[model samples]
Target: MYGGADGAVAVLSVAEEQKHLLAYAPLVKRIVRQLNSQVAGAIDRDDMEQIGLMGLLEALRRYGEPDAAFGSFASLRVRGAILDELRRQDWRPRAVRQESHRLRDSVRALTRKLGREPAEKEIIAALGITAEAYQEYQLAENAEQIGSFDELLQEGMGQADSAPSPEEQLMVRRSLEQALRGLDEREQRVVQMYYEFELSYKEIAAVLDLTDARVCQLNKGALGKMKATLQSA
Candidate 1:
């Protein structure tokens, strides 16, 4: 449909865009690697990398120079795209979802009855589960909740329709800061390093002299508490 000069310009434009995408390839890989650490074994790294590449392409199409730095913006887009894919997969078993709901309901009921957060033993006794079973439930619930929180963060980062206005964003930041204060020193530090400092789990573990799994546990607990606080606020 184009004349010779117009066709040549279109070809050159496509070539330039391809070159830009190639330039950002390493960034995509890094993001995939970082997110893959958290969800290892849940999804294949190669698949996640493919999702990240799609994200990078989306970023290239939508990004404007006056926005944030390209690397940071692109990273957020990549992470969001990967997380969106995970959400689409809905890999959690239906039974697991039902159990998580029951556990949440029990917690809410116990809190209402006691007028405070129930202790671990109290919850276990209320649920009529052995300590070992309760621990398993906690671990599963933590993983599920952390996944939800990650989705929340990803949505906040990338979705324009879901994004908060500046005033609302400031309010959320303040509320989150207040909620973080409710955590112990170590929990607060773990959250700050992981989210604010953008440190990987292993990196955070090394800095805090803890194992990777321990860091994950702490992060899960912190997010649970933060979510509760934010919801109450």
Candidate 2:
């Protein structure tokens, strides 16, 4: 249990707390940097560092034992804290969020039709918009949203500095595959097409002959199971 600030803490206890903070400070800094990059300048390093410090305090409060792998717990806490901050910012307009499904569908269709990476011009044409209007829409609607193809894939299939390492990437892929393997074949294909191929949920629903809500449920359920399995592993 954490003592109150006014309590007279022992010197050795204070020293141990200082040591723990010293050891984790670098990790917290790294977390802040990683989250800052992921946010694409929406929030700066210092802001994220402040949020990460709060996460560290929460982690320390809940950490059960010295040998209980604080780093992993702290990692999740920091990420959660950063995401909470982003949510509090309300970065996306509600209209944009509502239209994102349609925009994503358009993007997927345009990409599939082109059989290669579609240029912004191609995307605009497919969406039937003037270049100026498309640019405005992109700026207004898609600026800080996560989980899009352009953001997730990075430039030309290369990972960014913020992306996971090769080993972690492989582990994630294997974990996903294993989780999918346990699902019904149809559900597996639905998830693969939607996520791996960058097809939108609408496209997946159309191809799978299911309602959009059903598709969403299946995808969410599968992903939740996959997350649980990976975390356990």
| Residue range 1-233, candidate 2, lDDT tens digits | 31335432223355665677677878778655544533457777787888877776665555422333446546656666776788789755687666765776787788888888687667877888776655445543423433332222232223332223345446655765676677787778866775445455557778989655455556655655655665565
In model 2, pairs of residues that clash are none
lDDT of 1: 0.69
RMSD of each: 7.2, 13.5
Which residue runs of candidate 1 sit more than 4 Å off their true CA positions? Answer: 1-23, 37-40, 64-68, 128-136, 142-184, 197-233
Best by lDDT: 1
At residue 111, give the lDDT of candidate 2: 81
**Residue 192, candidate 2: alpha-carbon lDDT:** 76
lDDT of 1 by residue, 90-204 (tens): 8667897788789879888999999998877798899898776665565555555444555544443444322233455566568778888999999999988876566778889
Name the 10 consecutive residues with the lowest summed lDDT in model 1: 1-10
**C-alpha lDDT (0 to 100) for residue 94 of candidate 1:** 81
Q: Model 2 segments beyond 4 Å from truth?
A: 1-14, 93-102, 105-125, 128-177, 180-233
